[model samples]
Structures are given as structure tokens and as C-alpha cells.
Target: MDHKALSAHQAMLGTEVSRRRLLQLAALSVAGTALTGAPAHAAPPADKHTYRLTVLGTTDTHGNVFNWDYFKDAEYTDSANNDIGLAKISTLVAAMREERGAENCLLLDAGDTIQGTPLSYYYAKIDPITGGHVHPMAAAMNAIGYDAAAMGNHEFNYGLDVLDTFDRQLNFPLLCANAVDWHTDEPVYQPYSLHTVNPEGGRKITVGVLGLVTPGVAIWDKAVVDGKVRFPGIVEQAKVFVPQMRAAGADIVIVSCHSGPNTSSSYGDALPYPENASTLLAEEVPGIDAILVGHAHLEIPQRFVTNKQTGKQVLLSEPLRWGMRLTVMDLDLVKVRGRWQVAAMGAHLLNANTVPEDPAIAAILTGDHATVRRYVNSVIGTSAAAMSAATARYEDTAAMDFVNHVQSAEVARALAGTPEAALPILSISAPFNKDATVPAGAVTVRDVAGMYIFDNTLLGIVLTGEQVRAYLEFSARYFKQVTGAGPFAPADVTNAVTDTAPNGTPDYNYDTMAGYTERLTYDIDIAHPVGARIKNLRYGDDLIDPAQRFVIAINNYRQSGGGNFPGVTTAPVVYNAQREIRQLIIDWVSEQGQIDPSSFSTTDWKLTANDVPVVIQA
Candidate 1:
């Protein structure tokens, strides 16, 4: 779920009456008043069921064998370290089963089960040499058990053939409803999976699990997918399929949606940025009793979501990303007037610290520890010193530096070190990967993966030194203004308390930037657009030199036009998505023989003074 979109959505739900206004603008679906990008559906009665369905799920496990291995307690103490593995998960599963009863509890996972962590890596590449490519995830999942799961964007990382291998290895079934092969209107996936469990005496209870992945995935990973797959409109698919599931034999339809909302919205429906949630889908498709959401990795404890459009409540559980938390949702199934329905539901996260890991499950974890260590320790390449990721201290982090290096190097490699490489490569990447910060140490596979965690494709944007300054100025507003005493940020940017000084968000701390770079947070002139957010900037080392022409290399989307960032549309793109950062790193290492840490880290940021920071107050 994209929490970033929730703030704006809350403001739109109330203005639903003029929904017909959208029909005049562009594409509109008004099965019910389509609130902007929101879907339509009727409200479910509050008192419809007597029994509660307790569904617990995990997503983006990324082969997290145990809890957060990154945290070594307060002092890097191994004894104090808490591991997140199936061992701990089993405990949560057992407790939920005991508390909610097996008949009503549904355990699930949301996907990205293939890559990210060393464990998955071990199975993908390493395990093939010793044991087998058969991923241990199936065995691990079979231990704790999962009711249903959906496909995530990362599931396609190794390509469809490998994904099919993973599916064959899984103990549970894969659920996907939206992906199609284009030529064959035949479903790209199973569409939905139905489960029958006893909630009452000889009662037939069916749960239809539906899956959907982001449509942008094709753009993000165009290299392997190769336009072979088509992602159908999620809302349209639900309208067509959920009814089919209901007609088939499903009494309770649960959407194991890979889409979800970030928070509460008064908006008729939530757009949730990039992806829409089950709330929007629920309104468009009926018979869905609950939604188990994944993608965008945000955990929501209040599993019950009230639809802003229909006024009906639907059970929603999202454990965010990774195996960081476990969500348990209890659904009560009961016979109401000859029809069986969800009577009750509740959701909770297993905080790893709260309970002892089940020993049997621990043994399975212990069993795999040696193999995992061997895979991680296999050494992609040995670095003499520490290679770090981008830090809050300097915005030009190791991650950004590496990303820029990859994009620029690709341009350099493609152009083969010609005068074209002299264009002064400027790369832009999001600074928001959960694992963007890498520690200074012996570089390992996990360290590399963590630093470049985002699916963001490395992009190169061409800007003369003059226009670059304006872009810098726009990004600088995120910095904090230092009063006589200290710096301050907006409350929205920080968790800290605000005073007359202001709050502290990461963007507010422009002072953390390096010295060579002038902090753009301050506006020197009150009325001028130049030197602000890429304001009418010229293309030259010397702004007067119109003769200077440079080619920019960005991702396929930004090159074709995205981000609404101007000049980018007119900007020339010299590269495709084929050159990936990870692959580039692998190639870089392959050439270096042994990676020297010094080769990777660089002092990319330098600060400039005499510049006035922004003058915004809390």
C-alpha cells in the first residue's frame, strides 16, 4: 500500500457527487459513482456473520530465515540478537490457531518469495551446485502452512520460467487473476484459488483468493518480460471473475490483493498511488469477504477497512514488506438464513520479541543456516575496505553513487569512452529503499542487495552544469532552515516534536549535504523561478553557450516521458532498461577480478554556503 497517496485521497472522498464530471474528462467506470480513480461496490452489512475469519499472512519474505538479522541488539550482541525465521513464525501460527481455532484462521503470504535475501539467493544459484534448485521456501512454508498467496513484482525477477519452477516447488498454490499472455486470452495465471475448510458442522465454506501485480512492472522489467505479458485492469478483472467464483461454489470470497491503501480515507475510493487497494476493488467486485494485501510493504493492524463509497466494512490485513511482521486476521463464519458468511474478523502482527520460537521450526532454520552462510560467504568478490550505501549524513549516498555509476558507466560502456562520455552524466534515483543504507564492512551479497533494494531502474538525465543547479535548488527545499540555535523541518517530514523552530524531516536537513554542492533549500530571490526546481535553465557549462549539446540516458519510461519533470520529455534518452544496476554490478565485479572497496565509494557531495535556505515555517 502506498501511504504517500493516502493524505490526498482523504480530501477527495467527500467530493463524490460530481463523479459524473469525470465521465466528460476521460475513461470512467460508474457501476457506482466512481470517486476519481476509486472503484465501485455496495456496502456489506455490519452484522452479516456471527463467526470471524482470522487470516494471518506474510509478504516480501525475501527468504528472511528469521527476524531482522540486520539488528544485532543494542550492542551488536549475538545473544541479544533476535532472528526472524519460520521458527518464530511457527510460534505465531500456533498461537493464532489456538486463539482463533484452525477452522476459521487463514494463513497466507503476498509474494516476492523468490529474491532479495541470501537464502533465496542460495537456492537460486548456490544450491544448484550442491543440493538442488528446489527452493527450501516450499518446505519452510509447508512447516508453518499458508492458506493462499499472490504474485508480486519481484516474483518475475528471475523470469517466468524460474517462477514456474518456484511454483512447482511451492507446497501451496499460486493465485493470480490479472496477468495475461496477450495472444492467448488464456489467463496468465490460475486467476483464483478456492479453499474449503470446516467452520461449522458439514458446512461447505469456500474462499476465493485473487491476485494482482502492478501494471508498471512491464515497464520496470522490460528486459525479460519482453512485452510477452499483459496486465489486465484489476477492477475489470474482479467484476468479471469474482462473480464467477461466487457462482462456482464460493460462499466467502477473499481477495489476497497485492494492492492496498496506506491509511484511512474519507475519499469515495483510494487511488493508493501506483496501485489501488482492495477497498477500490471491493467496491467494484462483490462476494469478497476480506482482503489480504501486499506490495509497498506497509503493515496495518486495523484489518477492518470502511469503504468510503459504499459505507460497508471489509477486513484488510497487510504486514507490509519482508517478514518483518506477521498479520493475523480472524474471520468468523456462520450460517445466516441458509447462507454462510463472515461473522467476525480481527488482525494482529507477531512482534518476534513477544514469543519464543518453536524449537521444531528452529531446527529447520538451523538446518539451513550452514547452507545460507556458505552461499552468502561464497564471496561475489572480496573488497579490501568497506563499501557503504548512501547515508542520511550525505544525500549523495553510496547507493545513489553506485546507481549513478551504473547508469553513467553503461552510457560510458555503450559509447565506449568517446567524447560522448564527456556529457557530465547526471543520474536521479529515489532515496527511499528500506535497505538503502549499507554499513562499512566486507561487502557481501546481502549488503549489495540491501543498498539497491528499490526496483528503481538506474536512469541518466542530461543537464548542463547551469540547469543542474536549478534542479539542485528544487531538491534543496527539502532541507531544514538553521536558525541562530538549530535547524528545523516540517512536521510532515519528521516524527520529532515541533516548536517555533519547526519539525525535522530528512529533507529538512540540507546541512547534511556535502560541501562542493550548494544547498538549494534557501531561495535567494523571492520572485525568480530560475535556479528553482529546474526553472528555465539553459544547457551549458556556461549558460550563454547554446552550442553545447548533450545526450541524456534515463530509463525507458522517463526517457519516453514520466515524472512530469519537464525537458525530460524533450530530453534525449540514450539507453534502455536492458542495462540494470545489479547486472552492471555483477559485470563490474567480473571485470575487477577482486573488488576493491576504494573502487566503489566516492566523495560525490560537497556543500556551498552564502546560499539562503528556504523560509518555510511549521
Candidate 2:
């Protein structure tokens, strides 16, 4: 789910159903077929016939094999002081399996196995797994014994060839039921995986795991997935597969979905399905005992929803992203006649901070980690003055201007001889990282990579001045309405929580525009409502004309509808070379050999409230 669209979905369950009430229904959900041939009023089963199964799950582990921050060149830390990495999770999994008995335990990951850290990026682009080099994520997961994983949207970032190579290297199956071939509508990867667990002195239990990914992938990765694959809604595909799993003799069915439990989408009405639909999947589809939710990056210990048709409760759990936590689900089964039926289910999260990194996982990934570290630390160029994005979200800073500069330069160079080159060029950028900085003396690959964290590619879209104003108005929703401006902290004015963003809008959703060869200026007036926030919109010295035409250098995520920004998705694409934006910035600096802020930095925008400049306290 996009950070800006994490709002609670009220329409799916109607006004009468409270989210708390729905989550309280987490007890037991047995398949009606599993209790066949048993009397309706039969006596309770004896203790001897009961069996227990434990499932350990993780999600959105975005390529952190160790608890290190490649950008900072140190151990990763946050305000919460949580530890991250698969190494720490591996220790927790080992301890759980040992205590619960290895045979009764299964380990699974919900998705996003690759593509966040420098290590994952190195394998995907620099060293490339397609060249016979094993992906470090695959090697680490295999060593830690992951039974299966679903496909995350980021898995398609480097294209299908790299994704397929990583899949082949993994010892376990990479499953995604909804991701189907565009031509044949057949599954592009395994739909589900069946595991037969044999308990001590008990009948064998068949566990069926169905995997589904967010349909927003169609919009987010349109460049790579356009004619190759299509994604159906989570509930749409679950309704079809749950019955098949039951008919195939699965005593228990679990869904590992790379979708959130919320029922909202960032892409507005562009797609027919909601981007986050795990809760809907449970309520609409029957026979699912539990679900492992992903993609929202939320820490949901446990949530329960009642199936509308069966009146059975389905348990759902999601560990926070980046290996910060683990979800443990325990299911108890009681035998009726000679078959096992789900008696009860429970789930909770375990903090990875409490455990130490497993030495074995470190041993397997140390070489790869070291190589990435060296590559990121190598000096690229020198900066004449330090530039920081610490205040970029609330104020215009040179760090973000540097990003816009590189992007606009690349897009302009690509359109040099084309007919579109005659038009004015503008660029859009977001404050992806508040801590990103470039030192005054020297800049390394890590410094540049930190400024532009996402692996988004670049594209040029033509937009009229009216559409550009609409786009800025949409981005202005990131701020709360302030009547009179006094000195306020940065957080006091930004990341407004509204009906659309229950958790508050993230910094990445707030974009600022810069001109390539001309000056584009505007003021975001917080005294006015959202749609009317952009004030004093001007291009150079004249007011922007509504019918004026210009080309904007934008990232693929935005052009493909990532933030649901206005007009960009349907805008005419004049240039798309599939070039990664971060790499472009790095190459720009390397080629220039120096970063001088005076050449590119300009303050073209500011915040105001009723004609008074909004003052932000340090």
C-alpha cells in the first residue's frame, strides 16, 4: 500500500461493522468439508486426539541480511531503536522451531525478498544475478530455510529476467497466484504450494499455502509488466483457489498475501481493484484459516475477520518491514471421527531486537555484504558545500534540488534532437530521506544513493500549465491547514492525517517542482483548503498560462501512478529509456567531478498562510 493511502476501509464491511469488532473474531475457522460425516451434536474430542502446528512468518524484508545501514556506513537505528536483518530473524526462528519441535513448525515470508538495500541493488544491477551470480537474498533465505515466499511489486523492478534468475536460485518456491501471463492468462509462477506435516503419533496434516500480490503492480511496474503479465484482485483469485485446495485434501489453508488488510488504493479509479485487499479476501472468501499480510509495512500482531458466508473467523498477522519483527501463528486441531478439524488459532509478533544475529546467516552473506560495502564507499566526486535534505520536506533545500537537476539534465539530453526539445523542461522530486546528505569535501556512491533511495526509473511526460497546477494542489494536501502562521516545528505543519491517510502522509508523497532552464515559482498557502493551496504559480517572471505546454521529468513510479498524482499517468510520454534515477545522479556527479550548489540550487517555492510566510522553527 502507498504510505499516503493507508486509510481504514469502511466501505467493505459497511458502517455497522467496526474494525475492532472484526478483529476480535479471531478464534477458530474450520472448513465445512473437513468435518464431513460427523454428527452435528457429537461430543467433544479427547485430549489425546489434539495436535498443534506452528507457523512463523516474516514480510517485506527488503534485502537486509545484516543489521547494517549501507548508506550511513554504520548499524541501522531509528527513534524506536529496533534492530533489523534476516540474521536476527533467523535466530528467532531457530529458537521457535527448537521449542515447538522442528517437525511441527513452518517458516514463511510474505514477499519483497529483494530490492531495497545496497546489497540487493548490487546483485540486480551491478553484478547481476542473470550472469550466473547467486543473489545474496536467495542465498541467505535458503540458508535460513524459508519454505516459500510470494512475489512483491519490487521484485519486478529489475525486469523479468533478473526476477526469474533469482527465483531459480532459491531452494523454495516463489509463488504469486494473481500474477498471470498477459497472453494465456495462466499463472506466471506457482499458484500455491502444498506441504504435508507429520506430527508425533498423529495423523498427517496437509497445509495448503496460496500466494497473492497487490494488483497495483500493474500500475506501479507498467514498464516491465505491461504486456508480460496482469494482476487480478486478491479476493477474486482467492475465491477460485480456496475450494480447489479443499478438494485436493488440504486440511488447513493459509494465504500469504502481498496486500494490506486495509481496503484502499493510491491509484484512485485507474484500476478496478483496491490496492490493499487482505481484509476483503478473508471476509469474502471462505475456508481460509489464517493469512500472512504484507506490503503495508505495518506491524499487525493479529487481526481476525469473520467470513460472511461461513461465519468462520480468519486470523491475519503482519510483521513490520525490514526484518524488524516476526509473526508466530499457532493452530490447534482436534480429531473428529478420524479427521482433524481446526479447533483454535492464535498469532502474535516477536521483536527481532531481543535476539542476536545468527552467525550462520552472517557467514553465508558476509562476502557479498563486504563487496557491496566497498562499492558504495568508493569516492565518486567532491562537493563544494554540504547539502542536506533534513528540512527538504518543509522547505526547499539544495539536496533535493540536486536530484531535480540530475533528472532534468538527463531528460533534456535525451530529447536534444527530438521535436519535444523545443518545449520548456521541468522536474518533480520528493524528499525520500530526511537524513540524506552530501559532505562538503568528498561524496561517495552511498551519499548519492542515500539522497534518492527508491529504485525508480526516469521518464518525461508532457503536461499543460493547468494540469501542473492541479498536480501541485494535490501535493499540497501533505500539509495541514493553518490559519495564522507563527514559529512552528517542522512536524507541526507537515504529514497531515486525514480520512485518506489514517497513519499520516509520508514525506515521499510530498513533491516539489523545479525548472530545468527556466524558473517555476509557487507558494503553498495553508490557510486555504487543499485544492486551492497552490498560490502565485509563475513560470519565470510571468504568471503561468493555463494552456501553456511543458515537459516534466518524472520518475516511473509517479508516471505509472504510484502516488496517484494528478495527470501524470495519462500524460503523453515523450521519453522513457528505463534508466534508474539514482544511477543517473551518481553518473552526473562522476562525470562532472564536483558538486557546486550555485549552478543548480534555487528556492522556487515556499509555504504561506493568509499572505504571511509560514515560519518553521529549527
lDDT of 2 by residue, 380-497 (tens): 9999999999999989999989999999999999999999999999999999999999999899999999999999999999999999999999999999888888688888899997
Please give me the total number of clashing residue pairs in predicted model 1.
Answer: 49
Q: Give the winner by lDDT.
A: 2
CA error at residue 142 for candidate 1, angstroms: 2.5
lDDT for each residue of candidate 1 in 1-618, tens digit (9 for 90 to 100): 121222222112132323233222111110112211122111222343444555678777776655534311111113433335554566666655654566667777777777765566556554531244456566567666676778876777666776777777666788777778868856777888888766443456677777776554554455556568766666677778888998888887777777555422111111222454466676656567777777656657544556555556676767756554676555555677877765555555555434455555445456565567554444465555544433433234445555445556566567555555655444554444433433443455555555444333445445545444533554444433332221323332222222211222232213111111111121222122323422323322223233444444455433332322335544445555455455566556556645443544454442222343332333
- Candidate 2: TM-score? 0.92
Off by over 4 Å in 2: 1-48
TM-score of 1: 0.71
Alpha-carbon TM-score of each model against the true structure: 0.71, 0.92
Please tell me which predicted candidate would have the highest TM-score against the true structure. 2
